[model samples]
Target: MKDLNKQFSLILLYALLFQGLYAVEIEFNADKTLLDSKKEILELEGNVSLKYQALIFEADKIFFDKKNDMFSGNELKFSSLDNFFYGAANIVEFSKTKLTLKEVEFSTCPCEEKIWWIESDEVSFNNEEKIVSSINSKIVVQGNTLAYLRKANFPISSERKSGILLPEIAINERSGLDIKVPVYINLRENLDLTIEPRIMTQRGYGLTNELRYLGKNHNGFFNSSFLQDDKESFQVLETDNLRWSFNFLHQQRLNKSTFFETNTSSTSDPFYLTDLGGFMSGLSRTLYLPQQASLSYFKKDFSMRLDLNSFKLTNPLAVNQFQRLPGLKLNYFFNKNNFKLVLNSDIAYFNKGGSFRNNEKESLSRVLFNPKASYLYNQKNYFLESSISLLYQFKNHQGNKNTELSPLFELNNSLKFFKLSKTTKIILEPYINVAFSDQKKIINKLKIDSGLRFNPFKHKQQFGSLFLSNQKDIMIGTKLTHTDKANNHFKFEIAKLSTLGQKILFIEEKRIDLPEPFSLKLKYKTNNGIIFKSHLSLDSKNNFNLTSNSISLNFNKYKILIGHYFARNIEIYNLNNNSLEQKKINSFEFSASVHLAKNWSGGFKFINDLEQKKNVNSVLSIDYENKGMVVGLAYMKSLELDWVSILENDTFKDYHKDRFRLFFELKGLGSIGKPKESYLKRRNL
Candidate 1:
């Protein structure tokens, strides 16, 4: 076959040979040069160098055909440095759609090992089309260490375009496990989508996907994801069904004087959807739902913004939502020695669905209005403040036919104490406010919560404040936190609930940023040290129940926690005690897992309840990679395997063993849709 191809090429060459015309010389500094008598034909021997097409080339020996208008060389090579270079022991052919080299190695480097080539009769590279085609080719990537072959064609690189492309398998071993194949998608420049394509010898399967996006534009960052699985796949959590979630938010305007951020994310399903809307939105398959969103706007002189959020299942068993007063704030600025005005409002809503009056107490809402003004005296430490409320109320079925007007007022004066203290810092503020409301218009009685507080504290840390605010219905609270040497921190807080009106005390190791409120009272720390935190909360009923109780043994090596409640009495979608007691239970769950030595990770979990459970769910997973070889296993309950399927937001008992077992995730390369375009190559106006 090689002899026949050579003979054919020789024939084609001789067919176009032309008569000699003028001669040109190939100089050799040593008074050596090639003399050829032809218009378009030139040849050089012994370290020949020539230039063409804005590029330079060299060869051991070369031949120029006048009439044929062709260049040929044996044992020839060419280099354009980093762009494109090629070398061949035999022949080179160039055309519009193809550049064929026989026995050739091509690469962007000057070295051989990094070169990509094939052992074939012919290899064609097309730059305009970004395709490499080889006939009977054997291809090698990342050196000859790993090889795959075929008459193959592949696109080189993708730099631009957004959205999602069909996922490709990635072999990663960073998660303390060996990953063979993991499916993934390049969502954007900063975010990539990965599917939990986990399959193993000991455990079944699951599905997990990530959502990540970042922008320094308005000083905001948001990262989140959703994952569901029946099989136990986590080292720290054990449950038949696994719900996983993550959230991140940050923002700043470098050129402006405005900055505010908010973040709220959690993984847990405390709701049983009984509404028609739930099934239609395909929201039931997700075990846990997390919501995070923020808003920030800034300008010179006067600037104000907000961060508002709530993450709760909105369904049969629970509902929760919260809005900060800063959730809605306005500010007005004045010149030096001036006063700044601000109006802030906060609101919260929670509900459980069922038969209710036109407006039942089941749907709840609460709101607070505040108008405040501040004056800076002497600019740095002395200040005067005042604020008043126009209305405050929590209404449901118990509300009135005619809305009543509730007005409140206050006057405040404060001074910096730490400045005078011999200590490093200090602050002292004393404020008094009197509030009165007459609600006889709609309510049986009118109540006011106005008071005075003598607050003295060190803003630089190390002091406590006393609130003598019982002027109407005194309320007091204080928090203390400090991170000492050895990277350990202690935090404790006591706050008045204000509703049923009682105080709760919470203590926990301060980790991460601020500190998680003692709603659930769960506390945790690292393994390098032994630390324990306990939190107890009293409900509106005045019953002292353990909201969060956890203990760590062996320096965070083992932990036990028991508690149930959202952080900060969150009103978002969450189950209530009344509904669970009223409805008969209909579901069950079980799970267990172990992470053995040698990176042997394992887990198992199961769930059942045809009517209340989801028909289809995915388990979370990951893969491991080594050098150029990847191994992967992914298990997911097939969408077809669902026992409780929601169609059009309505769930019914439709069991399919096909969708019940789990979906298997396969790992490998091959994307769907279309190949992505390069960022620089893409034209956008």
Candidate 2:
């Protein structure tokens, strides 16, 4: 085959010998050039350099069949727009589109040292196809060999191609030693997949698959991970030895006005996430796994949805909670003149069986409708709005059916005064909101979505001072704000709320009397990365005692945060046995971080139980990072601090086993550590 190709090239060269060069142009300077008319050959020796079309070549000696436009060289350095290659023997043929190099050293790094490179026994590339291929190649970083491959294909253009991504390594308590190898495959123009195999020394192995697709009308991704745990160390959890999780997100445009979506997450067991060692897995620690699918339509000011949702409960006793087998919701709103009209309707059916709340099957179907109308009077400085709403609810549960109707009225007003200066401005705003509902009593046990009981009224604060209540209520508030040309801002607000002849309830199942105390809040932010914020809630009945408060301060690279919660302790009674003890919640949280240098930083965070006089969770870490690498050392410790143990007057468990990690990372490569920093960042700590 080689002789045949050489003969064909010779024939072509002889055929083109009489033809003069047309579009071909070459320019270079060399110590000597030799041309043989009969042989149809040209040779350039001694520091030969030439450029033809997109090819740039430099060699100690070059031989060219000028008629056929073929070049061969020794100790050649070859380069093009997308690639660079150096080898002792190099070949360029067919108008410089096809190249082959023997014992070549290649790299994407165009720098002098080639900090990262690949050495291949034989490397080839085709500019027309924009593909580079190599056989028996080894990857080296800073002269250190890191990986070897029998064959590899990499795209020379800005195209998606199949290749191996950087591998991942980590060490943590749950997994001990872990590594993940990933391969990315570009299956089509609009489809791709990443397959990763995870090996964990402590447990077993896992595989993660991520498939993505894009189409004219639909696009989405499907990701899943499966693991087999041979250790079976958590048999006491009553869970299977195999763990797995799946997440699917899909969106499809059915038409111009309709869309379909499915955002779902499901795991084999509720504790699977807690046992996993990823940021996503750790942050998803929940008792119930959620899966939902919905199809929706929109037209101008109207929208409708049909949804299906379900949950997997970790505990059998949680069967009392109902799942939305299917639900339909509709919303329509439009403005006519200065009046706004809105209508909302929802209907859902829920079912549960097998030893539920009362050891019997339980089912519930609900229909709710709400219509509201609001009239607004707007001005530059002041605005007033009045809204009226009608709510009707129908429910059928356990062979019992009930219907209720409620009417609500609300009034809101706001006024703003602004004083302007050359470089500063101050604004003072006062707001008032009053609401009333025509209902003799409220339903204290109105369970809504996800089986969460809700008070008849919902409380919300606006502008930091104005309180809005969905139930019968009244509120008054004011806000003051100042801003300067330096981009500094300060805001202060105070608000008060009063119930309409009924007690307001809290999520903790406690009721409060009418006329709640004034709530005050303050916030200040400066251009120099300084911020101060505080919020306080007072108990007016208890001589205006502090019910709850939180303060946060941030100056440059340092920050401190503290929070206090107040509650009435029923366990402790005064001498009269009727008076309860007003107590602050026995907990405090503190966190601070500072940047010690341009590439060095450290931080510490801790949560302590003041009553128990112990730390619940604490973490300390120091990190160093530059363009090339990142290193960190972190220590973490946590105490159980179980509420059940506290109730029973028992000491909680405390231990810090294998809670420290030393991390290292190479830029553009991967990291080895616990990967808990992402979890902590997600928690905003």
Candidate 3:
């Protein structure tokens, strides 16, 4: 019997060995994750931790199948396992170039989200394609509401792409216009272009399109607008006017750090002038328009730029159809820091045209090269630095028989000392800048300005300055924003920042009149969160004067702003200096604004010609956003209230007051999805 059994077993083993039969096999790790034989299925449980290709998965249950090369699990989380730098939702699907994340929160290696988690109902991505698609997503970026994107699609491909769209509007005291329609196209990972069709009761059919491309090594923009009807703005030709324009700007890197850039533009029909106030406005005729070009290559130690820009007008207004030319600049630097030299040249030629012929072409050009060196070293409680610069400029015009050369030298010094004793802080800074110009100008045109600033606490400045040139002015100001031990913030700055951020008080006409130009600002903020800022400015050579004030209050999620201006102003912007002359005029202005939580803001402003006893203009605007929906409205009434004052006192008094704005913005819905994506990504653990 034993012999018979042994023979039978041996026969069975032989049959099994020859058949190559297989058995199940598995390996377990201390973490409780298990790997199966055949290198296929991997199961992870009991506080399971699984890692694959820089991706780590953590969940109550996880599984992977090598057969189909698919991964999945529940209560799962996917993250960049190494740096713990990036991750996705409880359910994540990742591939070479694509990532499909569900309810995922990710961060930079250092952990900063701007507003952090980008929440969405669904997010599908393509890694190789650089495509990221999200539906119903919201995020907070730069403290601004970036919300309510419905079926957002961002294309990774450069040649073609589509993304979300946002609409906006503008309301000024004089006019109002609708903005943002059609679709915004993001292409080639660079340019952003938009096409919109709009209609206005005062203006006829119109379509506006803008294309802007900005990238690491290059950038450019092209814009065109067409309108069927015209309004008061065009004043030329007819209100039934057609308007169109195009702009191109490009920058390219010539080497690792060197680059060349050029810009040129053309336009037709002429509305480009009155709307956005572009150079195209200078060309009222189709035969002649405006164009500009510039090219440069340099970095760090060397740089140079040559510009050729002009508006060729076929139809002349008050000015001639001339060419504005030769706007050029060159610069060079070395010695690791300040040891450097610079030379610049500029010239403008004016031509002639129309019944108001201007055959006379005039030009202004300046050449200067300066070499300077400086040393700067500062410590915690004190800082001191000083530098001197030399510059020379020359001017010549065709009409002016004589040429004038101005040589200017100046020394600048800044010093500061700080002391902080527990609850109290103290700071003192004294600055002096003196410049001497041997230019042919009114007597004693040398410029001098000096000031002392004191800060008793952080950001609280008590500043005073005396100026012997440029309007021969003297002023004193103090400003500060502080938060006491009580946890309140007070803020202020007495500097010049236009409501729209424009550098004010520079008169091109009198560039040769003033020896030196200086602007001073003072602002204050409180420990309890109230703010006030004011600016006292002098225009070209300090002939005209201006006082601007801005106030802001912050309380929780609500913020309010108020601005007041008193202008003893002279000269108009853009117009030639000598062409039009007006004495310093008086005006008073007031503006107020309010902002709420979740991106809602509104503002109102009224400018009055106090000398004329009438309101020059007034405007009100409002904008709000609600979870993917954006709405804005504005109203402007310029010189309307003043117009009523032209009537008799009784009639003016009874003129039924003034009308405010009535406009709004709406972001309707449209999508780029078939909803059912056939190539959708599958989940991976």
* Number of the top TM-score candidate: 2
Candidate 2 accuracy as lDDT: 0.65
Clash tally, candidates in order: 63, 0, 39
TM-scores for all predictions: 0.41, 0.77, 0.52
Q: Least lDDT summed over 10 consecutive residues: which range in candidate 3? A: 676-685
**Tens digit per residue, CA lDDT, model 3, 575-651:** 32344344333455565556645687666656677677876666566766444334555554555332212211111
Q: List the residue pairs that clash in candidate 2.
A: none
lDDT string, candidate 1, 613-647, tens digits: 65233333223323222233433332332221221
Query: What TM value does model 3 have?
Result: 0.52
Q: Give the range where candidate 2 is weakest over 10 consecutive residues by summed lDDT.
A: 459-468
In model 1, the runs with Cα more than 4 Å from the true position are: 1-123, 129-152, 158-338, 343-371, 374-386, 391-403, 409-474, 485-487, 497-534, 544-546, 549-623, 634-685
Best by lDDT: 2
